[model samples]
Target: MAFIPLSVPNMAEKEQEYVLDAVSTGWVSSVGPYVERFEKGIASYINTPNAVACQSGTAGLHLSLIALGAEAGDLIMVPTLTFIAAVNPVRYISADPVFLDCDDSLCIDPKKLRSFCEECCYIKDGALFHKDTDRRIPVLVVVHVFGNMADMPEILKIAEEFHFKVLEDATEALGTKYLEGPLNGCMAGTMGHLGVYSFNGNKIITTGGGGMVVSQNAELLQKIKYLSTQAKNDELYFIHHEIGYNYRMTNVQAAIGVAQLERLETFIATKKENYKLYKELLEDIPNISIMPVVEGVRSNYWMYSVCFENSKVRDDAIKELDKDKIQTRPVWGLIHEQNPYINNITHNLEKANFYGSRILNIPCSSGLTIDDVKTVSASMHKLQL
Candidate 1:
């Protein structure tokens, strides 16, 4: 039997038409109409003043840090349970990442974050510096894990007190929104000083591989765009005033993104419907629990994640799912324990460590039909017997 993949992009016929037009126009390189249109569409969708498209989510993070002046020896706070790409950008800038724990929602725990910052940092020369590393903690990369919104209100308040720049990683949360408070109805990427989105193949939408950085600050957005395009000065050719990166997305990719963006709302709706079906079907299972949307937040349900009682049960379920030709994956390893960041400082990761082992991602592609969901649920139900 063929395996049902965990995730797949939903590319309608319109997406193919856009790419074909771009190819026929011979504007398949980095500079083209599709790139501009995609940037504007993304900025408009997220309600941001401007957006800068880049080659990948990692590149977008790197550019955001560079624009915010995150540098060597600066400490950045990141969640321990996120994908490595979210944390690896800190290393790209030669900055140290201090991993924070997650809450029941699998998002960064604001309580632990504040406590850690308060205990580990002190004001020196009017700047916040870590007590042990003596490095300035300049930025906080808050990830919206698996399309669920983090506690932005509390996190933003802490960022204000500590004077750290906030970079919202909405890479997995394209259509997620907070439903209450100051950020009421605001999209995930719009709540921070700067935000990034991913358009990778497995995301809600795809540009084959592309990302965007958005911010209300026009100057910062311009700087990010400039840095992404190798910091080229319009007045002078090959003029180098600053170190930059070649991270601009090709026009071919942006063409696909433009078409994909057009269908984002439809895809989000499909994902939510599938999630509801899964929840209804799995509600009676004792050892299985589906992730919940916070009372005041709306998730895109980018990946429908389920948690078993423990790692042993989760492992058994994985094997069973595979035997039935259904694809499933475990959550990311705790970033603090990873080889690259093992030496970094970490706060209490009790929840993150626990969830990391027990959690498994099921098939959540926008293309999954109602029958596919029923099939998956039936397979899972059989596991209980």
Candidate 2:
């Protein structure tokens, strides 16, 4: 039997036609019609007014920091349990990152965030400042972990109370949305001041490698576009404006993205179905349980993760599954524990540590079959016995 892989791209022949069109037209470079079409395609799908394409999610996040006016010595609040890419952008602009804890949703804990704001931070002239590090807290970077959105209502409330900007790293949550709330019908990344989405090979959608930045401010997006394309104010005489980056998404990548975006809804539906199949088959397994999204949040279920009794059981399960050609993985190591961010501030990390050590992701590709889920579930149960 072929290996039941973990999350991987499910590209159909649709991508080939688009790529062929781009190549045939000889518009495979930084500037092309496909780039504009891809940006508009994503913006229309996500219900955002404007979107800017970039080379990668990290680049998009870094551009968002620029859009928010992040500077040296600024503090950005981030969750400790997210992928490292989400936090790395904070350092790119020379801003400090202070780690926050995650709640049951596996997103930032709003209660802890509020407590930290009230107890450890202070307001000066309508801006927040961290007391311990004495850094100006200007922005809060929120990641929608595995397509499950953070509790934006409470998080936004805290941001309002503390006077900071919200920049969402919705790289994992392009199709997820709030079913009911003040943010009802609002897509992830759209609620924040500026948000980013990734189209990596393993993402719900793929552009080979690319990202999109969405915002309501048209001029800010224009500035980001200019900055992405080397900040060229004039093309004829090579007039350079400010510092910039070659972060624009290539036309070939955008062409692929346009095809992927067309099938995103179908991919999300398949993911949800497979997750349900796994839950039904494994619900009775001992020492194991599947992770679930909070009520009213329609998760894309990008990667179906499980929780073992402890770290040893999780690791052992992964090893056992790998022996049978089934791919599985443990969750990311906590960002706070990573080498570079040790000196940064960390709030009450009880839940983040708890989930960090126990959570393990299973095979959840859009291409996964019901029988494949059954195979994984049976393997997990055998481990329990």
Candidate 3:
């Protein structure tokens, strides 16, 4: 059998057709019809008033911060359990990040967030300010980890009480949504003040490398679009009033994104079905269990994670899987632990520390077959002996 891979792009549909169309039309740069098409498709899917296409998820996040008026001395709240991209944008604006812990859902813990605000921060002139640094804590970046919806309602409540903004990093949760409660029918990205999605090769869908930003505020979305395209005050005379970035998504990428958007639901369905199959196959096995998505949410199930009894067991499983030609990996190192962020202040990260070592992500690509899943499970079962 061929080597099974980790998550990868499922380009079995109209990807080639759209790419060729984009190439033939000579509108392969940022300015093209396909870009608008992709933006509209995403806005419609997310039920947002507007969306702006950007070079990557990181770029979308950076643009979101700038549009939200994040400044050099501002403080942004983020989860330590998330990818570094989610935290890097805070530094991009010269703002410091106050890392927070994650709950069982592997999303930011609202309790800790609220506690930090109430215990370590104070309200001044209707804005939240950290007591130690006196920096205004203006935004909270929430990541819906592994397609699992974060505890948004609770987090939103905290943000409201603290007078801070919410930025949803739905890069890994494009199709995830709430199934019930006050946020019923709300998709991951649309619930926050601003949200971003990625179309990287390994994501559920792909545009090679691209991202989209959505917001309820159409005016902000327009400003983000202008900022993404160099913020030209006068296009004809090449006059620019403010600093901007060349972060616009190219037409070729947008073309691919438009095609990928056509089949997102299909891709998510495959992911869920495969996740179910893996759970069933490994249910009776000891020493490991499939991590469950939090209740009241329908996750895209982009990555299938297995939690081992301990870090040693998880590492052994990873090595054994590699020898069996099945790719696997551990969860990301906590952002607060990373070298660049070693000095950043962090709230209680007890749960983040607990799961960081024992969790291993198995292959869960949309293109993976039943036989592949069975092989992975059967191989993992052998490790018990």
lDDT of each model, Cα atoms only? 0.90, 0.90, 0.91
Cα lDDT tens digits for candidate 1, 243-297: 8799999999999999999999999999999999999999999988999987788
Itemize residue pairs with steric clashes in candidate 1: none
Poorest lDDT segment (10 consecutive residues) of candidate 2: 376-385
Superior by lDDT: candidate 2 or candidate 3: 3
Query: Which residue segments of model 3 deviate by more than 4 Å?
Result: none
Rank ordering of all candidates by lDDT, starting from the highest: 3, 1, 2
Candidate 2, superposed: residue stretches over 4 Å from native? none
| Model 1 local distance difference test score | 0.90
Model 2, 14: alpha-carbon shift in Å?
1.1
Q: Is candidate 1 or candidate 3 better by lDDT?
A: 3
Per-residue lDDT tens digits for candidate 2, residues 112-212, read 99999999999999999988777899899999998988999998888898999999999999999999978899999898889999999889998989999
Off by over 4 Å in 1: none
Model 3 C-alpha lDDT per residue in residues 1-385, reported as the tens digit of each score: 6799999888854878888898998999998999999999999998887789999999999999988878998989999998899999999999999999988888988889888999999999999999998889989999999999999889888888889999999999999999999999899999888999999899988899989999999888988989998999999999999999999999999998899899999989988999999999999988888999989889999999898899999999999989899999899998999999999998877999999998999999999999999999988988852
C-alpha TM-score for every candidate: 0.98, 0.98, 0.98
Q: Cα deviation in Å at residue 276, candidate 2? A: 0.7
Question: What does candidate 3 score in Cα RMSD to the true structure?
Answer: 0.9
| Candidate that scores best on lDDT | 3
For candidate 3, the 10 contiguous residues with the lowest summed lDDT are 10-19
